[model samples]
Target: MTILGSHFVDFDTARILVADDDPILREFAAVHLATPTLEVEVAEDGVFALERLQQGGIDIALIDLDMPRMDGFELIERIRWDDQLKHLPIVVVTGREDMVAVDKAFAMGATSFVVKPLNWRLLSHQLAYVLRNAQAESSVRSRLHDLQRVSDLKDRVLRLSRQKLTGPLNDILDSAQTIEHLSTIPEISASLRRIAEASVALTRVHADMGEAERLTPAP
Candidate 1:
């Protein structure tokens, strides 16, 4: 339930998928991961696994590196490109111990890696850790997105307010300029010219404010 000393997965309420080309291995894993704790589904290959995933309701996935129709690497790529499933936790279970393959799996967004002929006890603990971390990460990302959206909305409001203020200032400056040019009184014209200058300054201030608002980051 608790992972890395933080957060809980509530595994009893979770659903997991096990995909392998070997029926015996698949069945073994299904039995191993299944307890009163977690629900498990088995797929014979990557193709079937991907199909079942798209049908929805999968929280975590265990994939075998070798399979017919489609391989684990290709399956990871497809899952990464899917908007709804991109964040799903993928754990690669393979006998291959090559450093290159391990790095490649991480690069492809695998949440974890495990060698085949699995030690069921360690795997159960690892799976619990992965699920807890995944849930915590998702919660953080959702909060960040909400914060960004609110920030963007605030920026737009400031920009629109500045824009509304800028137009009136511009009109006032133009009217003051016209009145100043037509009048013969030097003192009145000087005051009008000062008023026009203040209007221009206000316009510049709002123009800068609008630009700053536009530069705010989006969600």
Candidate 2:
């Protein structure tokens, strides 16, 4: 990870897509977004952008609102609907100040908005923020999934232990109880005490495992 301004950017594995009809704007975005660790790919239109996205490994998309063939809004909607691309962060770039357009872009699932005649430096920071936040969210989801798997495995183990060990443990407890009742000799009584204590310990362990199973959160 490399520090850009106040934010840490792990751009070594980050791939960005810049989609715009204008060659100059696309080049400007590509250049500004690119770093030694980051790779930026440009698309002439939404169609090309969608194609590149389909190919995968695009961490974020910088898209122009107005373009020929497929517009940004349509592209955004399509991307949002796609299972693979739904979680992808998209920042819409537009010259229009119209609230309706902005609202529509957001409604269609644009992660952020950037006005054209771009501030290259600020744009870089904004993109970094979006990427970082997305990455963080993704990390959280992955960790949650791993935790859930562990919880599930614990539950399964608890169930199996109870199923397999319960009968034998009960037998041990029953035998200890019988020995306690029948034993009269001092040595036999002492053995009974040890057996009772061991039985109690095993029962506590079984109960604790059951409690852990109950406490384990559902996926």
Task: Report the lDDT of model 1 for residue 99.
Answer: 57
For model 2, residues 108-142, the per-residue Cα lDDT tens digits are: 99999988678877787788888889989999989
What local lDDT score does residue 18 receive in model 2, on the 0 to 100 scale? 93
lDDT of 1 by residue, 1-219 (tens): 545653333464688999899988888887777766689999998899999999999999998878899988899989999998999999998775665776788898888999867887678778888888898999999999998888878877896798689668879999999999999999999999999999988888888887776676554
> How many pairs in model 2 have backbone atoms within 3 A of each other, for residues 3 or more apart or on separate chains, i.e. clashes?
0
Best model number under lDDT: 2
Q: Which parts of model 2 are misplaced by more than 4 Å?
A: 1-13, 68-70, 81-84, 176-186, 189-193
lDDT of model number 2? 0.86
Error of 1 at 158 (Å): 2.6
lDDT of 2 at 177: 79
Task: List ranges where model 1 is wrong by over 4 Å.
Answer: 2-12, 96-99, 172-208, 214-219
Q: Indicate the TM-score of model 1.
A: 0.76
